[model samples]
Target: MKRIGMLTQIFIGFVLAIILGVIFGPSIAVVQPLGDLFLRLIKFIVVPLVLASLITGITSLNNVNKLLSLGGKTIVYFLATTFFAVLIGLAAGFILSPGKGVDIALPTESAEKAEAPGITETLLNFIPVNPFESLTNGNILQIIFIAIAIGIAITTVGEKAKPLADFFEALAQVMYKITGFIMKLAPIGIFGILAPIVGNYGLDILLPLLKVILAVAIGCLLQVLVTYSIAVRTLGKMSPLAFIKGIAPAGIVAFTTASSSGTLPVTIKNTQENLAVSKEVSSFVLPLGSTINMDGSAIYQGVAAVFIAQFFGVDLSMGQIVTIAFMAVVVSIGAAGVPGAGLIMLTMVLQSVNLPLEGIALIAAIDRILDMFRTSTNVIGDASAAVVVQHQENKASLAKSA
Candidate 1:
């Protein structure tokens, strides 16, 4: 038999895992340790990867103006795509009305509140008290901040920084190799991670809120397929099909793992190798995008907020819908790049529109299932943004040369 591609292997493994999960039930959970090991391995290398790649990319630029310009463009693209995602989510919720006929029992107590840090607090936290501490905590945003600062400082130091810059460049290369090694285990890891989830929940949990789940899934697909495609085609001036094909590996990993950070290594590698985006752009944009470019979560928040309101038979005013959109954009920025971080941010969105906090309990059961889709969407958005920004930078460079 001809060899199957890695993507096909992962997809097959995923489908079989679900089948076995439905048949074997939670007994399939025995292999969960393999998944946990995969997650741990990814997490183990992320900090160093981000640290080395960002610093090396930034220092290599050797031009503060270019760095700032790229940063501005990246942030603008992220915000714009995120806003579009929110609008898509709102449309999905309004059209699908996922919560209209559902009657789920509210929990006795509210879901454990994972209060998102205030905007001001989040900004302040970016400046780490000790950079080493941030590394230890695996604080991605903070690490990016510190990495850029170090890179800027290196640029100012001129020739004196060559050794340090080369050292980090080498480190980044090493991490990429290590990432490849870890990714070899992806099919097994995906099986291990997904089997238990499908086994535990089965179709039973899905029946009650199937509409809501479908709405979220549809919204995510629209964002990735429609919204990001437009950006890639028009803005990035690249083939949408090519862009999707290039990022497929990262997207698959993101789907299986349901983590932006967990899939970062794969994302960076694919962006650089497959998409041919410069390391400078991929390193800076992908990491920043992972932290803040949560188009998928924003879409989910819009859908969930509206679903919750509809479930409770509450008619939201135009003002409340607008508030949900605004809050979704803002809260998603502070959302951590981990599994289920969006749930906490969803609480804030619920409160913005005077929706009941208890509504979260209704969706909590299947959040993981939905998370897998949204997380994949988020990674795609990040990769798309990187491609767009890289195109813009190349155009600018060509114009300057002319």
Candidate 2:
């Protein structure tokens, strides 16, 4: 017999979990270790996966100056869109109130809510004085800073630094392989995790999950239909209908695979042939967008962070809200363009503001569902950047001739 697809397996597990929860009620908590074990496995990989992948990702860019000169328009467009995407997610979270009706126990430490840090204090904490201390503490933002600093230095030092860059690049591959291994256990983990949530809270808990799903789905649609549509029509001089039609093939691939990197060939092909982007423009912008542009993931993070906060009854202050948007954008720089990468990135968003990690399990069971929508949005966003950049370059060339 053929193997079951990962999403199918996960859906099966999700259904079974709810059934078990309803059947056994609170008694089903005995299987909780399955969830804990899965979480620990994910936690084991997070630090190394992020550190190595981030370092390699930055190192691969090699010359930051070269990127700015060649892909500057694409980069700025991506950054602006990503920032707006997060705000949209925040709005969806607050307005839709996805996590409002749920009541779950939070960790004792998390239960004692700390004062929200000021903007200055938040910035100061990102610069790990002792990098090792940050690693030991799992200070994600600091770790990202260290990775960026080291990666840039490696690039600046030139050929002599090849060995260090190679090491990290290889380590990143290893971590990715390990993460793939762990993800296979997701069905069991979801079963363990969700069963208890349903058992205690009853089926009403599933309503929030549905709302979470709706919020993210709506965000994805808005990003594509509203954000990218306007971007292509205004700056790219391409109609929204044309942009949507042209990018549909790649977007479908990205949605099914939930991996931006995996969908690049289709994206490049569609951007060039369908969208009329020059090969040079499509080649540079789409690939870079794949690595760093994550408007959809940003939206998901914003919604998930707010949902976690609400679920835990943790009141989010303005500073905390800003922190979520900032962290989502920053972490997007290093997030892997693979399936389920959002789950790991979500941890960073949660850690930024001291939200409970256990809340991850609450969302984990349905992550693949959200991943589909976000990955599709990400691919389309990348293609849209190519369209816009090609237009800007064309205008500049015409100006120079004149």
Candidate 3:
């Protein structure tokens, strides 16, 4: 038989896993370790991949001003898209009202409460007290900070830094090669990760929350299809269809994994190779986006917050809606790229608007399914942002030449 493509293989595995889970039920739990191993393998390379790729990308810029300009544009695009994502989510929540008639009893386990740190503290935390500690802790923001600092230092030191820069450049290449080897195992990994989820949760758990799930799904689709498309076409001057097709590989992996961070290697590869975004751009934009961009998470938060409020018959004032919107944007920035990180941030968003924290129990069961779609959307947003930024840079370069 002719060999199946990787994407096709993953789809088949996903379908089979779900079917087996449904037919065999908890007996399929035996496959859970396969999934855990896959996750562990992905997590194994993330810190190093990010650290090496980021430092290499920054040093390659060779100009401090360009680095700063790219950073500014990337952040602007991220924040703008994120703000729009929140609005879209809120609109979907209001219209769909997923929480209406959700009569499920709140779980007996109390919701874990975590206070949102002050903005100043968040900013300060970005700078690692000890770079080694940051790496050991897998503190992504701190690692990015140290990487940028080291990259800039290499640039400032001029000729003296070339050897170090060259070393990291080589390191990045090796890491990419390693990533390629890891991705060859993606089909198996995806199967391992998804099988247990299907087996344990099954369709029954998802039935009651179907409306809320559908609302969040639609909202995420809108952000990815409509919002990002408009930005790419109008600002980036690129065909959105082409953009979407190019990033599909990464999107597939993201959906299966439900992890932006775990899917980083694939995202970076697709953005660089398929999307034709420059390595310098893809390397910096994607890793940073993975760390900070939470468009999908922001949307989920908006939808969930409203869903919970409506479920409890708590009337939200106009001011409260505005607060939720603002909180969605803020909390999303702090959300890690791991699976279910968005749910953790949801607590902060709920608390901001004084929604019942226990309301989380209502939808916790189906979060995995919801997370798959949201993570895919998040990866698409990151890839799209990189393309848009690159397009603008080319336009500026041409204008300067003309």
Model 3 lDDT at residue 344: 78
Q: lDDT of model 2 at residue 358?
A: 79
What stretches of model 3 exceed 4 Å from their correct place? Answer: 1-3
For each candidate, the alpha-carbon lDDT, in order, equals 0.90, 0.77, 0.86
Model 1 TM-score on a 0 to 1 scale = 0.98
For 9-122, candidate 2 gives per-residue lDDT tens digits of: 766777888798899999999988887786567557656766776577567666777445545687799999998899999999999888898655433332222333444666
Judge candidate 1 at residue 378 and give its lDDT.
93
Q: Mind sharing the TM-score for model 2?
A: 0.61
Looking at candidate 1, the ten consecutive residues that score lowest on lDDT are 1-10
Candidates in descending lDDT order:
1, 3, 2
State TM-scores per candidate. Answer: 0.98, 0.61, 0.96
1-402 per-residue lDDT for model 3 (tens digits): 128866677677777887887888878878877777777877888899899899988998898998999999999999999999999999999999988887777777645555656668888999988899999988888989988999999988989989999998888898899888887777777777777777778777688788888989999999988999999999887799988877887887898888898889889988887778888888899999997998988889999999999999998999999999999999888888888888778887888878888888776767778889889989999999999998988887799899
In candidate 3, what residue range of length 10 has the lowest lDDT sum? 110-119
**Stretch of 10 with least lDDT, candidate 2:** 107-116
Q: In every candidate, how many clashes are there?
A: 0, 0, 1
